[model samples]
Target: MKKEIPLAITFISGVLLVLALFIPHKPFGNLEEIFNDWYIIVSGFTFLLGIDSLLGYNFGKLKRKEKDAPYALVLILSFFITLTWGIVEIVRTPEHNPFGPTSTFSLYFYNSIFIPLQATMFAILSFFIASAAYRAFRAKEINSALLLVSAVLVMLGRIPLGQSAAPYVITVIFLIFAVYFFAESAGVTEPKIKIAYILVALIFVALIYPLGFVYFRQHIPEFADWIMNVPQMAGKRGIMIGIALGGIAMSIRIILGIERTYMK
Candidate 1:
């Protein structure tokens, strides 16, 4: 009964929320807003839970004389420093804001730590991309070879020299390379030469006219705008619906005290 009741409530609430989207009446229309407020309150508790968990784990490690004790110490120190700084800044500010120009410690932390860490995180992505490309562009198979060629052409097409000299040609080559690679990977053709020719024709037709029109328009026009707008929005909506349902299920479990994992 513990599990069954909560599960039933989850199912009912989820269905009601989904129905609320189509039928926008009083109470139903306000459902999402009420849920949003509930989410904010839950999130505050979750943040406290995270802080408690972090302190417990780090303090436990420190007591046990763990191998990475120094790192844990550093993490704990940094957490406290940031927390204290934030609280002080909030209290000093006129309306409990720590972001004013007068907040020296806030400005110092933002400049010294936050900005550098953000930059370092973004810089790591470049190394990751290089590693992935090295593993992917081995050219052991026809598809890999086509992918390598398309990647090279696309890189070249982005250059000022390629754009000025033969932009259409470069664009067409990249497109054909992509299509051929996709087709070969999908097992559409066995003959490499025939596949290449078909890819070339597809690229020529797709790029030549479009490039000419864009050149005349003198502005960057999106070719896949419909795909971006319609399909992408639909996919996002579906994902959000799934997320809402999952949240409702979890919330029901929490409210009914069915999920005691938190207590542990």
Candidate 2:
């Protein structure tokens, strides 16, 4: 009865929510907001459960006199200190400043402790990013080499390093590739077309106009920006579509009661 009741609720709720998007009338109009409220309430309960689990685990370590017992103690002390401050603020000055500027405890802990800890985490993350880039940019394969070059150009173009020249450089590279590809194709097919592409490439390389550097400075960033915005955005959209479809399929399975791993 317990499992059946929850599964029935899930199926009904899922179906109604799906229909609500199209219906948008009466109870359906506010259903999404109601679900948000329910989510908050459920998440609060889950958070309490997590706190209980943390306490149990840490206390067990302390009781066992583990090597990391001092760290566990520090964790418990930090949690209680923060929790006590929050509870006191709620009871004493619930109508205080929105930014909590009035509460010294909250302000000091957040600015002096929290901000540094957050910054330290990000500082640590930079090293990991470098490590990932090292692995990705390894010249073991043609694909990896291409990826490395593309990444370097993209990164440099966005940053101050390649601001004035990246776009023109990238264009030159594209022209070279185009000439080579057309030249190779011409060996098999029409000869005149290949000659035209070669001449076009040379002309682009040799062409000179007054104040060309000034023009390039303005256009280069825009060209580099296009590379990121167009091709990269298309790939992002494809991945997003795949994720959405996967989520929908998983949700459908849960609604149909085929997904019951949690019940195990």
Candidate 3:
């Protein structure tokens, strides 16, 4: 009975929410407002539930004397401290608290703790990326080799040297990277020709690149931007479509009451 009741509610609410979009008048005119109110109520309760779960988790860890117990304790203390400060501010100046995104507590926390921690994370991420890229760019497989080659092109076209290089010079360098990588898989079978191909390209760049930079340094960043805006945007759009379709399927599942995981 308990499960059936919630499932029925989900199905009806989901249908009504969908209907409200297309039929926003008369019998269902107020569905949007009604549903939004319900959402606000549920969200309030959900926030409290999340807080309860967070504390319960850390308390359990503390009780068990886990090796990471200190971090758990810090998490608990930080949550309560931030919550208490924000709550106190809200109660003290209800009207102003609406704009309290700039409140002293908010500003202090964002600048002193949040921003510094976020910057530190990015700094750590750079080293992790370098190591991962080293492992990935070994050209072990066709796919990884392609990824490595594309990545190298993108990187070369992005940095100051690439940015300073002349337009034609940059294009030639990119072509060389592609050709050199392909020489590995194409059964070229001739080592001397492959070596000569790369060495000649390098020598050419070494000689002409400075002249190109002196004359055409302005076009390097533009070339990189073109690659990203054209090819990268196409890939991103395809991914977004996939995400939207997945969301629609999930919504249908919920509306049909096939997704009961949320109730549990």
Point to the candidate with the largest lDDT.
2
Q: Looking at candidate 3, what is the lDDT of residue 210?
A: 57
lDDT of 2 by residue, 1-264 (tens): 989988998899999888888887879988878988999999988988999999999999999999999999999999987888788777888886424777878888889999999999989998999999999998577688578766756775577757566556556555555566556655655567767766665664554231224444555456557778998899999999999999999999999999987673
Instruction: Go through the candidates in order and give the clash count of each.
Output: 0, 0, 0
TM-score for each prediction?
0.61, 0.74, 0.65
Between which residue pairs do clashes occur in model 3?
none
lDDT of candidate 2 vs native? 0.76
- Mark the 10 consecutive residues where model 2 has the least summed lDDT: 207-216
Model 1, 1-96: lDDT tens digits are 866666566667766777789888988988888888999999988998999999999999999999999989999999888888888778766564
Q: Tens digits of per-residue lDDT for model 3 on 107-165?
A: 78888999999999989998998999899888767688677756755676777676544
TM-score order, best first, reads 2, 3, 1
